[model samples]
Target: MTEHTDDTDDTIEGHERELSAVREEHDDADDDVSLSLPGLSVDRRDFMKAGAAVGAATASAGCLDALSGGGSADQETASGGAKNHKVAPGELDDYYAFLSGGHSGEIRVMGVPSMRELLRIPVFTPEPASGYGYDDRTSEMLEEEGGGYSWGDTHHPRVSQTDNDYDGRWAFVNDKANGRMARIDLEYFETDAIVDIPNQQGTHGACCLLPDTKYVFGVGEFRVPMQNDGRDLDDPEAYTSTIAAINPETMNVEWEVEVDGNMDNGDGGKDGRWFFTTGYNSEHATTESGMTKADRDWVKAFDVPAIEAAVENGDYEEINGVPVVDGTRESSLNQSDRPIVRYVPTPKSPHGVSVTPDGDYAIASGKLDPTCTVIDVEKLAEADDPADAIVGRPRVGMGPLHTAYDGRGHAYTTLFIDSQVAKWDIEAAVEAEAGSEDPIVEKIDVHYNPGHLIASESYTADPEGDYLISLNKLSKDRFLNVGPLKPENDQLIYIGDDEEGMQLVKDKPSYAEPHDASIVSADKIEPADVYDPSDYDAEFVAEGDESIERIDDSTVHVKTYVKRNEYAFPEIRVQEGDEVRITASNVEETSDITHGMAIPEYDVDLALAPQDTREVTFTADEPGVYWVYCSYFCSALHLEMRSRLIVEPSE
Candidate 1:
């Protein structure tokens, strides 16, 4: 560990006095501990020492695990008890799962291709009356304004699969507006539980340890109401920033620390001691007409408790006298500017945090700045001085956000400028430094405009060694139209390869507001998982055929009528590795809409024209139920024209 001189203006004498006072206050509070302030009894002196030890141990262990080429098995085991089944090695095909949020709400998932909706699990709500009007405008407005339908206001779902005790199933969605913590259950496809946390306002970014741990570490910003009214954004307080350890299961708060203000503070990197960033502060703004906008500011850091106390008391303010911007006046929080202190080439609105698995370097992206700042994580952890902590400067063109590293030392980041993804070689960075040359970061554009990138991973099946998945915020036009439509329909975007780049393979009138997605194992299926066709049985015969026949237990042959130019079918189910054959015959005039079936898991795509009877055979090796729809973006009832295929076990 290297020690750097404390570049901070605070003298050693002042720090010593503050430390002693904090220790004494902590000791006295221990004798009268209260349930409301759990984990508030530990002596500050001892806590800091213990924190250093834990931080060191965790960082070392993380580095060793990364070096060993350990896969997600360790993470899964750490998130909860080990399952009897292991994730099969390979890539799973991607598909979309629609979550019904009713009226105006967001549709969230894990990746772009496999958009599985994270539905709000029924929490024993009172049942509605038989004649209850679902179309009540007042009821819809209440849900929208009260955080029921606005997923964006409530959740900041970041990828946490690599943290010490984190499980892939637990996606952290912070309720920034209401200060609530939602642990989305991926296994059950619902929000299994909701934990109310104090000082949870502006719960921006969160991460967890692997497998079975109950706690998640998070950071949040604080705000004071304007004109004594809780709704107005006035008296913007900078010091109201904190980093907390929260128990997601019981909704218990462990501890929180306050970082320096004036520096925009949110997002952190956890290794041994949790390292965070801080920014500047601005005052709340009001127009001449009395309309107000919230304040905006820079980033900063803190140990934790100071932050919790500040949130409790509205007196907390940013340090260094950074001029405050009127929040009530600014359109976006990231747009405000404040003084940049400490680090060179100071970043504006620095938000997301990431560190190398080796504990060698740390990187953060400024929400407003186009460049990323890199620091020496290990040195910063051990340093007596902040100046000595900075490692190197590797500039990334365009605005950078959520970043991920392949255990092998390569880093991947997303640029929001053109919605392109970039790849970086960290090993090459080290070599460049050794040769006295700056490391060059490479960019591989995905051509998708992603608003907030969740995570990326290197897939074994891909030649580039990585497949990045990101969340695309709804376009402005799409966001304004969220709700039951004047006419019901869905929208679809088909992806296909082209000589120049990927092309819009097809378009459809079903599925809208698609977001984050995930890739799950496609190999797990059971015989019981299959669905019976009799559930939606319909009878129709071809122009020349008299009737339909069942070739086998799994196969069904249908006849079409000449009057019915196109036939609408019901959902089908099959087990993994089961062969499915759909034979269609056109009995009327040639139909313009091309008939095609897509098995997203198998990556099998086909296209058939009208008046042509064709049999498409495919093996559903994937386990989950997939929706099969016509590729052509045809008509008003396209939402109802889709069918489902439930893939089950092969036995």
Candidate 2:
């Protein structure tokens, strides 16, 4: 274990505080003889440690042992024991799940079966602990491109595809608050680039990739300027449901199209010779003037014909997904040249949209309605009358938010108001004649308001996973009272070949409020575990990294490396009014080896993974001494990785 220089008083003080906190927690747990709760994963100090990842980082993608909370038993009731998902510490997880840390503007990485939180990937917001917003390079990404604004609300995370399966190449997430789309390279699991959806103010249902990985789409959440500035925000009819296609290779704007009226959030799209995404008022709502409850209720009964007609007659001109117009509203919406997107309206304030495995049906769920609206894609494509394209709106439960398909035989829809999961046979219900058993098969109750339930491999071409994680919004009485704002509980459930029911297995406490997640089998990913200087890419990225340097009298470029048992950096000395830029890279050569740097009294915390680089620029306005230390725990001597920053008084 090594540090930048001799330890200072600030360094010692911070180290003592962290050690004391850890010891107090362990000591308190030791006093409690029994650690049991109603349907919670048993607490294990060993599993909670950060080192549990060092050994299991190379494990395969299919272990059936129960871990964390709950018992692993093949039970048949609500209170039955969990199925076989238990595993030892440092054991490889069968899958890797990436969950959006709602308002925190980051994504949490967890392993399936064990339900261990392995990593937190910063996305739209400034994560000081990970040096995300502090790193000079990434700090720019957090802010609005044309403005000084930073911080964003990230909602959905969708992994890229190869052959319709998770290719472990890219993961796309949406910034609902910023209307920005980000691409995370799976090789390093770091956000490489982010492209703003031009002409839109906010984004919701975005980053849905096509089957062949040719193009990914970003749909605007709100009806804003839509490239036409100064549009009256009060007029909902003036707003448009705008969407754009981005070439995956370049991650640049290819072409975009729009239709009139508020379409809300979209879905992970499916294209069978053509692209499709059903609409919903999913937070990224309309700008209708003083939209009354009555107006919303009236809008709930949407007319699919108007939507279909608008899309069909959109007068689109661009071909092969190319950009061919000025970055203006009229130029973008020439009406003579726009891609048409068919709309099929349904009851129930729709929130999410999904397509079945066979690409036969597109399902949209209304959060306030008691049923979900289904649109048959194949039928719509071949229909002589596009106005009559809605397949059915099967009554399920109140407030259906999102749906996950099990490529095998069923679809699971999360009912928010009722806190239940409604299961139905997709093909059976889509093709079943009325009065037939009604494909509405069963219902399972979860702990609290469940926002999203991801079936193993749900978003893929085939669902090969046996676990289902229900991301609940409210913890309620599920776990011990932490505070007024309880942690989000992501409960793990077994959704195997059992024709009976899915059983609750574990309760994993989550950070912030998680929105949506992406999980693929571990075998599907092959990220290099070592830090290769050649792998680093971003603006101002240095080929060979080193510790502290004085680029100029008033400017400093400090580079550091984070490795197990050590964070190497040189002493930092600056005068008041000096602009300090720190470029920190984690050059560890092992999988899951990550480090973070945090400077006291400054909002500079960043996560550095093997070969990943981030830079932070800050002006030393205050004259004082500050301590720099690693925020993420990576090794037994992680505490030893510390440095001192001395800001001398200006003359």
Candidate 3:
């Protein structure tokens, strides 16, 4: 209807400007909204722009997303949960600090108290099969009748315990010897349930997480016949090893991973990282079927040809196609003394594993070598190849056995060959500058039998109180190679504060073969009161007299020398509402020794340094023969340093 004016270019330019203006306005609105959010109060526009800048900067700096030092999205999610719980930053620091030097020489460093070595309860005692008139019967029959037969005649199975949170009164014991896991009530110490897991023959090294998680992970049986046979590993039937996942709650086999090799011992971290050893390809003994003496001798003379024939005939195969070599047959086989497989070195019997308190990394002690390896847990979880997941090598001199890390970033490792415990300063290494040439390991030596050490963390009531509990499994006599089959004594060595440096507070005897331990709170049980000798009837004695004479009704002082380096407590009898006081002194020259006392019925623990004394007060409300013993780890006779307190009825 009107004259058409061709203004197409002008119209397009004008529309473009309008669109840009709208985008700017939207960005402003987004910024306003973002700036008003309570927790996320950053401007949206600014944040977007900053993100772009950061991306550009990171790209220019040649950084990968995975290798970036910043935390990942998963960490953000985990922190979000932590934040929602309103955990104070200071509290988190305190928690970590408590796990570090706080509980230095005890079983638990923080959180819930762990169980220390109270006593080792034997589940079986065998008599002579001939005397029992069972010589004609099989060993299995005799064991079956014995009621506690576990693993035929062997009883060196690893043991671990965990308390049930839901039932509160129940605890579980993973009895590797019996190929069974059993549940026992904590209050009564009685077995409630026992479940036998399949394919658990020759079970060792078992552990579990707490609460409702009823699963226990451990190493499975080794195919002894196949392993013992000397054959080429290229055959598929040469090895048979597996890792078992057992559901202790239901006593069922949940899952298993066939490793197809020898997995001797293993340990699991709290974060689900498991460390173990794998035997390398080696030759083993073999007995051929339908073969005469000549054939056997020929095969023994030339193993390679025999192995080839076996592989060709499909008569047998190496387990996992890996050879099993006997350590004793190297000279006959014309093999070098060095181990086989030079490049991809097999993990030869990895025994002990310990994770960092933060669950970021783990250290595994290699049984075949003197060095220990570190594993980056996050990288391992995401890695396509497990062999490549090991982070670094921290050479621990001699044969390393157990590794433990406190929250303060210090790692402790034990050397089995020399019974030495070495503490390494990991924090300094972690904080060192990137690509620095400084060495990371700092070693401090202590007395320990490296082959068997159960590392644990613990904390104390005093602010500076911290400890590390090392359950030394080998006794001095055994290490020295001189004693009557001394079953390795459990030594609880307390590494605590000493003016002469960090000295051992107690190195006392404990339950036999105390492999692993935990801690529990004194107040968790009934009888919240403490015990003191002052509130009880007093007695007096001459300097050298062992007998006591009752002097006062409430106070007792014994003049006899309590003996140096001894934990001695006087026997006391109290009624239901009576109080007790006891005093002790060390006549020895030791300056910093700590002698402590505990009444399990009343849950009282008291400690006094050498040449010093302390007192405790408690009401004997419970009627029982409560055993009072030294809480401190003392010397060889420490187990004998026990006295009984008799709580009687009040008239």
Candidate 4:
């Protein structure tokens, strides 16, 4: 109802251009006529205009129901839908879904069945609430890459796997914007390490898919020179990308395999013997037209153990301080004695590659086509011709992007153009001839443009077919009008074992955006509610013996302890222009009795969980008394928990 801003205007213009192109492609079909409403009549074109007016958001739910003619049926079946799967107040959910916070530079943990956001774990960005990036320990971790990077485009999140099932020991997320990968300690629910991936630009997809997470793997989505030190700027043919295998325990890049073209999202086999990724830019094109000119791209399969063996045998070249293996076709077909990579041709511009739960097949979605190519995982290494590896090409729907298995011989594919999810039988698809018999079992209309959808434990060896979360790209009129920008929608669909068809259960407003997520059963993860002081160094704990150690003329170290409503160091005095180091230890032994400290004028905040210790360093530049108080609620006397830092003027 309000005038569009400049950004909104640009967005509308872009959408208009896109719709115009769609109209031209369809020869300007006049099938979208006016619809008969209950009292008022609205044309389909006018309804689309309303969507465009709201910053080209997704269409209203009522509009989708009217178009699909299944609204009343959905309401009538509500009793048999997700109502049975609801988690009442004071009850716990059955699963933990870790969602990648796209562009927000974080990971969100949501409880399944309830769809409630339990916690937000900041990975690639600073979180002020938890004092993650501000604390001394986390700040040092962020400064590892020497760029002072603040934000990252997080894409895919994978929970560590053991024997192809959720291990729940660690969660890995990739920073697509900064070419970095982070590891979150599941027990502490905190980011423990961040490894800067060398010889890559955009780390779009990474996962700890092997058993016990032997090595975390990732691929560069963009191609660049091998060294990428200001060379081959104009030559597109000279550009290449890589897939890096990192040591999960050490959090270091052990080896990288150079590929010919840019790789997209990837998944590994259950045996940990092979990994597969979708490929594009195979023509080495610089322009969009040239990039999509080819009729088919590839689904590349890499021999994981073979590549590692090659690296072990001193057959890799060092680039950017990393051992780089030549996996490109130019190097493999001509120079290498044995092939370490196989490029199986698939439909144009594949986007997502997923391994089936049984580990027999790997499905690659065809983004530009209406099909998904299924390749045999074992045949990838033995097939003389790459074409022999592919077993099926099922025509799913318009703009199929990602596939999630139900562990019941069925696969659900997200249709971007159709705004729907199609369920198909995998074996039926493989047996039937292409375009002869429809392998699609059912199709459920999502809100709009669902980019990625994940079934409960879809990527693991044991997938539960209880529910599926559709990561819809837009929520347009789903909620109250916010502004020019609206939050994305994460729709919960009930695809339970006994259900006849998929039922739309609830629409949750997701933060900013989320690309992909992994749902693990609740029993798989057990995090610590209380911190253990013995795990940290003894020097970090104060043990109620508060003291100030003057290391040098301009340096001072103050050690303090905190309890329910008191501080060991009630007051600390320092001289102006002095470098001060303060160490605070929460001596509380109770679980969930966390403590925090904050200085009034200083940019310092510490989140001290029970029995947790933290340190902060700052320069005492102001010649005034600064009050430090507890930032986390502890007890009834929480407000009285305060200490004073007095800074005297330097002579």
Candidate 5:
């Protein structure tokens, strides 16, 4: 995926389905046959193999099967009338992928088995159709330092969990360019809150939540010279590469501590009683550089001190004061002055690290090295006296950037430079003899430069690792050239037991640059439908505001309600040159049934969550009819969820 800027037009808003080009590129598999054959349970590779034997007619029949990332449901066609009710849409793909929309500052929701784009949640960016930055309710959220920033370069998205498992309540994403994090309520599929990380200038590798979502960790990618200027990067203690741990409930930085090395970015952390981070670039130089052993690559751990523990110790007076918050309530919590943290060396350029499902080990990938390292989770947790915490290092392949675990004790590492993913037994490696050769169990070749490999993976106490999604950075010859910059490729790989093998199942194209993604089961989230006027709590509006009214002849106040596939509110009829104030309320409670209001050509778009009311003001300068419709794809009637604003000439 590529980095899009705030100035990008509305063209990037649509969910991608690069079907025609994918067909053109893989024409050799395009056989012509009757697609109405019996037994619709054919898998992805079965479609291709069947085409090879049954002629071109069969290839053309299952073309959509290839486009949809391969599964039993794909054969259903648009009418969705295929007799196979076993693996239909909303059945097999009970999991949803929340991916970073890169510089677009949006989060794309994709169904797992089908890879279908569900909804686009606007956060740090100004979406004209959703009226995110254009509307006052969300306008203030995008402001950087002071004033405001237009777009975001979003990087990591972490789903909140309970007891270290995906509970499906909310998802948190970070804006690398802006040093901020935002929360998305999964049930409503709407952005609920955003807060800035303190002491961090550049937010990168923010694998925020640990087990049970106790905290979201963040560190500066490029540490600014805090005390030393033009000096050696050797001063790891003085380096400004500080990692901030935020309280998920209050959105407060409960603790901040300087990492023990000079690093470019602290990739991500694995949670348990002890939290850990993997990173690169300690003792780095711009032009003059000599890499030391400790500076080469490293994995670190931080012990999250509870509020009770802080009080028990009675003011570690030398500690810095805790951070303050700015939201619905104004409260301050004390930041732990001295948090217990430790680290050990690893292969060069360790980027992504994760804890295994059974809480047995922590796995990290080295981007500059061929193999990956698996450290004992038990040893890491009990390392109070020891300085080094490494358990075993297994060589997998070239440039292993990240690792994903399947609940059945297998860890899959993505090899970026090698264009492959190395799967191995995590427990075996963790228990292997030191200095012994540990080889990977399986290596599946992928497209060029696979960045992140996501399974039904979560940073919760319990992990679900059934399937994998390879977010490949390049789509080189996979599709027709849109221009110079190519489309991204994401493939579905099944990690189930029994008959199905560990192979590529489905492949599809993602238009924008998607950096990282996280998945959650559909059952965990509860969305809303239909918002009523009585439940609205309006803090952003004038004192004692009513549902609907005419303030004066020049200005009118209108209240509107929205829900699934329809709107139950009145249309505004105002005179030309009159000031208009519209408050739109989304009355919804069903999971993921949010609504949007977009007045195209008028530069007005608003995102309304269930029982949420937001106001937007614009002048009815000319006499014309403006159409308002839902910007985000909610369901079958998204396009039909519309209303009209008729502007009459002053008479």
Candidate 6:
């Protein structure tokens, strides 16, 4: 009984073997056993052995013994309860989370803490529910470049910022399926502009410049020919990608800087000086097998000021009516020229690159390796070699994809293969020895594989460490079995204090897939409850403008007004082949009162809030009386509100 052996291994592989033994001892034990840890509920031995074995085993033997006994929390479930973070009925949420609908082609506004979906703003797609693409005003915006796109794959949603903090005036999102970007006005909660990016394909990463949001930058994820005029189809070496800078005010492409490799994700500096994006395919691989051959990829950094200055000095070439600058390593290193782009080498196939809240360090996640590479941005600009800028390579876990901040010197990174979130200390990681486990504080298992995670205001200068959302890709048995397809699970975790750990408070089911989201405080955004006709074009009328004008022999412009239970123009007469343009204005000044206009046989629908005006244009080809009714429930007499459009036969 007194046999003592000091054979316990301190190395990672040694601890890994010890962890295997612990796992075998608990083979037949209940895996759902609650632990004394703040939010852990799995079997004590299994929890330490499975997702976070190596990091846990690095601790002293005495600490491991205490963890196995299950220390203190008397009453809690495996997924953590929501008693403390519950949002009562009729209560307002503390923050607003703008989520990008991956393939849904829209932006979903959700209330934080409550996980309630507030609105779905259609950006690059047509929505029959809100008449987004059906209305003439939005139709013009969609057909601006003459592309009839019905769907889009939105990736990232970035809010406009001032002084490195959210200003809440506009939100920018990218369409991965189509090379385009959209701007959503926060006040009206509507999309105002959509721009097709020139000379860039597969536009993936999008972010507004910090400190003032001077420009919105988007990076192309797929490499293609610079001319793209049916040339260099088989030459992988000739293909390259470019990062374009868009003028936020005009929503136009200002200039583009060509770079090496294919970019994936990006983040901007707090001072609006640098923009960095991850390159997952640095090998310039045409096939999937060739992509993983390289031991290291890169995070390409773009000098924004230098690019802008080059454009002003006309030190660039022209392609498709846009200025293009050569920023490749070969051209940048020639004769010691001022480089506009620098490629900082990182571990294999990096996925997401995010800057720290303080804007000091750029953390790039290693997708193929079990670590994250942290680079010093200031040093990166002047480094003679790309590898010299790297400060630390913290061993987090398997398949680290993205990182979020707590503003308390901590970083929470999502491990895709491990299906867990690893919380690490930033300063400790940079100062500790390589491969040391001191940086990793704790890790908790999510429901399934999570691709992206976001904390409250994590990307800004002042990150509030209150909550985090895990955008998991699978929800196997979390809810009732619903046919073959299931909704994605978005787990909400309370990440308030250092000692609280990550408590899984709720499991919110999101439709299809949601890639990324930006969380901001509620006080920063002030949405308008109603619209003002005075702030719109003169063609919109709130009073005394209900008349029909014959624009030409076959075109008519019908100006109509609406209120409670009535339409100003009860009947409109037009010829069979006449082109009809109808503008419906709601004159009600109440906060919640809204009106809808719909024509039965025609694909026409419009939603008008109080004091709002919208237009619909269509050809009256069918010679019949179409009943127009209110599609939205506004009042008790909603059923009685109707109008008739009589299309007479041609003489």
Ranked by TM-score, top first: 4, 6, 2, 5, 1, 3
Clashes of each: 80, 36, 56, 0, 42, 0
Off by over 4 Å in 6: 1-83, 332-337
Report model 3's TM-score to 2 decimal places: 0.44
TM of each candidate vs. truth: 0.45, 0.73, 0.44, 0.90, 0.71, 0.89
Model 3: per-residue Cα lDDT at residue 197: 43
Q: For candidate 6, list the clashing residue pairs, or say none.
A: none
Global lDDT of each candidate: 0.38, 0.60, 0.37, 0.78, 0.60, 0.79
The predicted structure with the larger TM-score, 2 or 6, is 6
Give lDDT tens digits, candidate 1, residues 84-118.
22123353434222222222223244222333232
Question: lDDT score, residue 175, model 1?
Answer: 51
Off by over 4 Å in 4: 1-72, 76-83, 145-147, 333-337, 538-543
Which window of ten consecutive residues has the lowest lDDT sum in model 5? Answer: 34-43
lDDT per residue for candidate 2 within 1-651, as digits (tens), equals 111122222332343344234223322222111111011111222211332232112111011122212222233333233455776876799999988877776778899878888877877766555566566666665564412446666777888887677888888887777777788878776776777767666677654555666666676656654336565666554556566666777778766666544445554434524454544443334432233122121111112223334436553444334332222224333222222333344442456777676666767775644556667666665554443556565656555788887676788888665555777777676575422336766665554568887887887778875888888775544456687777777877776755535666677777677788877899998877755666546432333556566777888767666567655654677888888887766766576777877885877777777667677788888888898888888888878878778899988
The ten-residue window of minimal lDDT in model 6 covers 32-41
lDDT for each residue of candidate 6 in 62-135, tens digit (9 for 90 to 100): 11112124332223532344346767899999999999998989999999989999999999988877788888
The residue-by-residue lDDT of candidate 3 on 1-651, one tens digit each, is 121122322332343344233223323222221011111111212211223233212211111111122321232232222223233333331121111011111111222112223322222221221111111122222244323453221212222333321223333444445444544333423233444544444555454532234455555444443443465455544444444455666545554433333444444444332333333222222232111111001001112222233335443323333322332222222243221111112233355665555555556665434445565656554444443445555545445667655445556666554344555555443343322213234332232343444333321111122344455544432133344443443333223322211222223333243354333333332211222233223232223544333345533332322433343435666566665544443333464445555665675554433433333445667777988776665667766777777877766
Give the number of the best model, judged by TM-score: 4
User: Superposing all C-alpha atoms, what RMSD in Å does each candidate have to the true structure?
Assistant: 21.8, 14.7, 26.4, 6.4, 12.8, 9.0
**Tens-digit lDDT string for candidate 5 (72-100):** 32232311232121246446567888888
